[model samples]
Target chain A: MKKLINDADDYVDEMLDGMVAAHPDAVRRLPETKVLVRSDAPVEGTVGVVSGGGSGHEPTHAGYLGEGMLDGAAAGEVFTSPTGDELAEMVRACDGGEGVLCVVKNYEGDVMNFDTAAEMAEIQGDVAVEQVVVNDDVAVEDSTYTSGRRGVCGTILVHKCAGAKAAEGADLDEVKRVAEKTIENVATMGTALTSCVTPAKGEPTFDLGEDELELGIGIHGEPGVERTGMLSADEVADRLTAAVLDDLEPSGEVATVVNGMGGTPLSELYIVQRRLSELLDEEGLDVAEAMVGDYMTSLDMRGCSITVLDLDDELRELLGRPAHTPALTV
Target chain B: MKKLINDADDYVDEMLDGMVAAHPDAVRRLPETKVLVRSDAPVEGTVGVVSGGGSGHEPTHAGYLGEGMLDGAAAGEVFTSPTGDELAEMVRACDGGEGVLCVVKNYEGDVMNFDTAAEMAEIQGDVAVEQVVVNDDVAVEDSTYTSGRRGVCGTILVHKCAGAKAAEGADLDEVKRVAEKTIENVATMGTALTSCVTPAKGEPTFDLGEDELELGIGIHGEPGVERTGMLSADEVADRLTAAVLDDLEPSGEVATVVNGMGGTPLSELYIVQRRLSELLDEEGLDVAEAMVGDYMTSLDMRGCSITVLDLDDELRELLGRPAHTPALTV
Candidate 1:
């Protein structure tokens, strides 16, 4: 039950307050709503890109808000989906008049909630809204949170790629096309060394033996493919990489994002990166870009995930586009 | 004692290899030396600013290697100092014909090692090497790692400020002065909810009781002021802020970095920032800039630190200058 929080109910709000205090120039909160909008939202003629999901996953949606990234994010409670009303607020706030694109994770709650927001936007008129549901996790489909494959760190790539397209003045349909392309090309799989604690739960969401680990772990501390005896760092990387590459065979030049679930150190992430690079080299897939850090995280979950974005020329150009947000800038 | 590492001895090398692989465009490994240099080092006229210590503090010395950051960083063994030979190699590799300034943390091993490197650089006769030892941690004057206050996260600010000055074409002496000024103005204090593990040491560096914490903990997982029962998050923030602010007596406006000790989640850090912003407001100090995340970390320690830099116009301008490194970009 050890956590640095005031109360379970106010955790998301207070966290957002702290975020606003830290980056007032970058993001702002909609009054009384758990939606964070880029301060420069509705940029004249550019399509709006909005993404969001549960809280706890730091820097996922909101942390990707900025010039070449998401225009806004509707935040849910820790591991819970955002409400439909908040999604509607986020959509309206981010709409730049050309159109708005919602990048939803594959979780059922998120898909349902954002669909409601899109319906509301269509009902209200004036602005068009499009939605793309990312289901990149090769680890699980039909999890506790979703009816299909759970979206994981690859969603960050979707935000970056789609947001880059949106910033290029692409309409809602174009942005949605690029986003769906990303969803089709990216695959992710993770392994957890330890469980995480959501504020509401105030305890470890799951438990394992001292020398055990869960492979193909989901971000919300859900059960993974299996709990097995701990493997060496290289073995773990090989397993995760095999799972992801099997799902999406990346060739030519690919972009890799080795993401750390909260609580893992950067050194370990680099170790994972080392093994991944060797594997990619052996497979003859040139790595165009490799991002190794905490882009998406379960709240203090000690683990790591490898996301490989099978890159063609357009995807490479979009991923390389310059962007600035609180946690990510590339 | 679960950690994602192979052979303990290969940890630093593999980690550095991974870093280079992930950021080949940004950093490179000098052959046979435990040094990572900017890919475009020895810029011919700009002063070379180099910093280093033990290896586990990621994004510390190496992460700051880029356009407006350190020209190079010497990597030592895990939680151990780099050899004088490695530091010397770093200075020579970064020299650029103008001069090189070594930014050393205030630790006995680091100080002695860099002192040796400075002597060697002076004797070998080409690069005029000047050094500024950062001793900004206000917790204790002498502790496990040094005869002076152990440099903690505040050292990152020194790299940032000095690196900016160096990038602006400041001479070696001028960059050293700004670095020293950063040391004079910045103060930091940290608390540990859990100790860290060095790859060299196969187990936790220190032990803490359940619901217990240690205030004023050092970066090396050394003992802190005393072990005490866990307090509310706000209470923890109040004490850490008081310690740093009392040491600094910062007025007007201040820049802050609430750094995670690697294992704490961003939500917890935001909670700490929530209370810290309140404290600064009450004390009549405007926060000019606030960075909340893991910048410098001890392996996988679960804790946090607050660094407050009292800024004047020049320091503020220098700190705000654009810089691009692996972990930090501003």
Candidate 2:
């Protein structure tokens, strides 16, 4: 449990403080809630986009709150879902004249909370809210935190495409439609070389043999479909891509995201991308865009995920649209 | 050691392959050398900025080769210096008619290699080459790989400032001057909770007890100034700041970079920045800019280094100048 933290009880609040201080122009916390909104919120014509799950996967929901990405986020504690009330407050904070779109991952707690928040936002009368549940992880049918396939790195693409649609003056339903479309097209699979320690737990969420890798592991230390012996970068890439390919029939061009699960070196992420791109090339799918970095992460977990978005022209436009978030700027 | 790599011999080459594939629009590698130049290098009227040392530090040299950063970089094997021939080839590849400025870190191999390259370039052609050796580590006066303090994370700032100067149509002398100025103004100190394993060695570089941390560790897994019981993030901030402040008397607005040594979680890095900012605030130094990410890294070390730059107006403008590199985009 060697972590750089002050108090476990105040970890989320303190992290938010540090984040706001670090990127003051990019994000700001609503006065009393765990909701972080874009510093200049309620951009008059754009539909507000909000997303959240837990705190450990940083630069996710909160770091995406900026001009061309998320408008706000409800950050729960590490690996815990934000309350529906917290999410509803977030929807209200950044709702301009247009409505709000909620991007919820497929985790059970997150789905339930965002669903309740959408109803609450509609009931409150000012903000019309729609939700899109992302289930892009082709890893498992069910997991510790999720009911269906777990949403992993592909959710960042959902946020990007949906936010781009909203920024293009799309209304609530249109933004929701684009988000759902992104969810349908994107698929991801990951392996974990090590588990992460949650601040509250003060211990690693899971353990593994030194040379083993848990393939298709969930973000919150959920069991993967297989626990296997160590594999080379090529073998790891083959396995993860095989799982994803079995789930998705790809053609034409695709956008690839080789996401680091916290503790993996960027060099290794690039290594993974090398092998992953080779696989894509063999499949005759042109790599439209490749994002290789730590877009989302568990707390110091050593692993990575590969996400491919089977793209069409419209989705390509949205995916390639300029985004100026703290984490992903183009 | 658990790592995603193919042949250790091909580690640097494969990483660069993935890098160029991912950022074809920003950078391209020369076929004959490990030199990564801007996709459209030798910008007609601008001075070329070149920096390189090791390859394990992804996004340091190669990732900085784009519109407003390095014009070229020679990629060496992990934790090893690029050969003088490799670096000279890079200078030749990106040497616009104006000149080239080589930014060398203060490691023995790196300084010697870059010096040799600069001389080789001068002897071969009309390309004027100037060098600025960065030694901003306030750690040891001398270490395993250096005659003086090892230039660690502060070297990234030198790249940013120097590259920005070069992009602004500065001549070789001006770019070299700004880089030298940055070298004098920056100070850094680091601590390691765990050391990294170089791929070639196939073992951890160093080891520590469960509750120990090495203060002021070098990027090449060299031991820091001291080893002590692990401290809280607040205590760690105080100790690191105290050491750096003793060496650098920062006045006016300052730029701070809390760089992860590859494996520290962004959450914990923020926890570190929270306390670090508090310390700087207490010392009456305004934080003009703060970068919190793994800008420079040791393979997969689980620790961080804090860099502080005492800024005046010229340095401030250079620091703020737009950079469109694959890693640092503004």
TM-score for each candidate, following the candidate numbering: 0.98, 0.98
Question: How accurate locally, in lDDT, is each candidate?
Answer: 0.89, 0.87
Regions of candidate 1 where Cα sits further than 4 Å from its true position:
none
Task: Kindly state the fnat score of candidate 2.
Answer: 0.68
Docking class of 2: medium
Where does candidate 2 clash, by residue pair?
Answer: none
Give the per-residue lDDT of model 2 (tens digit) for A198-265.
Answer: 88888777788898989988888776889999989989899999888778888899999999999999
Q: Candidate 1 residues B1-330, lDDT tens each?
A: 788888888999999999999998999999998899999987788999998999888878798899888899999988789999889988998988889999888899999999999899878856799988888889898998789888889888898889899898888889888999999999999998888988776788888887998999988889798688987778889999999999999989899999999888988898889899999999999887899998889999998999999999988998889999989888
Which 10-residue span in candidate 1 chain A carries the lowest summed lDDT? A1-10
lDDT tens digits by residue: candidate 2, B256-282: 998898988888888888888888888
Q: What is candidate 2's DockQ?
A: 0.77
Candidate 2 to truth, TM: 0.98
Candidate 2, residue A55: lDDT: 84
